[model samples]
Target: MSEPILSLEAVETDIAQYHILKGVSLSVPRGQVTMLLGRNGVGKTTTMRTIMGLLRNKAGQIRFDGAEISGELASSRCRAGIGFVPEDMGIFSALTVEENMILAAVSGAPDRARLDWLFTVFPPLKTFWKAPAGTLSGGQKQMLSIARAMIEDRKLYLIDEPTKGLAPAIVSTMVGALRELKRQGASILMVEQNFAVARALGDHCVVMDDGRATWSGAMADLATDHALQERLMGLSMEAG
Candidate 1:
């Protein structure tokens, strides 16, 4: 395989007195989704935060496009073309959808073409263009969060649970939008709990256990091996 666009080698992180990431290592190949999966509180979000420079890695290296970014600031990381959509959605609730998106476009005013495409991927953002973000439904808010990150192109996206607590139909829509993002050649490292979502969107997969990446392989392999799924993810994916 070609060299990964982003790679973490023995990356470790700490929060106060807790060691969240204990030598986590993984790679996100260019233009593919690498699902970061684990049961709750296994440091999956920590891994994402560490990569985005929200939390500094105390040891090891984080390389993005062949440059070490371990010690970089979060704003520097953002400037370097890494977009992040945190689990909280990170939108300004009081602001209109348009206002939220405008702020996310760091370089300048939002790109018209990109906004148009995102509107197709998520139509509600356009429907509620002038509506306060807080007035949107849960799914719409999630879409707006993703749309903001995607308002401007980025080398990679770090997304956390784009579909958590949504109806099945909304999850399906989220999956479709993400698939479109993949089609547009976006490299993404995502943390998702919904096994179906992970299985559907992941090309490559990494399983984290107790603050470390314990397994890494094709998502297909993990999906088919029920025993492995049970062992790593602690639950087999039940068909719907």
Candidate 2:
């Protein structure tokens, strides 16, 4: 669409001597959640790491808001509005929920309206504001991680396995929060193994296999294509 906010053209990444992402190409359209799905160990996390400059791309290009960002350092990428929430959720264990949120505060005063918006989306975080992050449950910790990311004024967010270890109810809450992020015009690239959660939050979808993109289309199309689902994701609603 409207000039993708982020574009990865033939991106290749390696960990030591191993080539993990072999010529993967994808684009994150502005204001949409582009779900990157694949079985475990399929280079999904590597893709996110490469985008954030945590890992360098051996080949191809990465462009952010129309400018090439492939060669930038991790901090440079962060400064360029690329926010990331790793699978570990990266919350400081000793810090209180409010302290964790404050650590992400930038030049601006952490956008009071955005913090309020996050509170509306994740009520559990609001309740745990004064508690230590280490004391919160897995789901609550995840909410704090997401809230910290939103405290920064970033245009793009790269989130990995956001619903991994939560209860079904909390998973639904996470889905709703991500949907609201899209409504607020934030572009998201999410790597998810939970198909139902992906379908609920994604507008576009890409399935990666063997370190490369094997399928890409609108999420609605993928939903109805049972054959494609089995072949690519090895999943379907009936089987689950």
Candidate maximizing lDDT:
1
My TM-score estimates for the predictions, one after another, are 0.97, 0.95
Candidate 2, residues 1-240: lDDT per residue as tens digits? 399999899999999999999999998889888999888899999999999999999999999999999889988887778888999999999999988888777555677787888889999778988989999999999988887877776889999999998999998888888887888888999998887887788899989999998989898888778888998977784553
Give the alpha-carbon lDDT of every model: 0.92, 0.88
What is the Å distance of residue 152 in model 1 from its true position? 1.4
Summarize candidate 1's per-residue lDDT along 1-240 as a digit string, tens digits.
888999999999999999999999899999899999988999999999999998999999999989999989999999999999999999999999999999999899998988998989888888999999999999999999988888888999999998989999889889999999998899999999888888889999999999999999999999999999889877897742
Q: How many steric overlaps are in each model, in order?
A: 0, 0
TM-score of 1: 0.97
lDDT of 2 at 202: 86
Candidate 1 Cα misplacement greater than 4 A, ranges? none
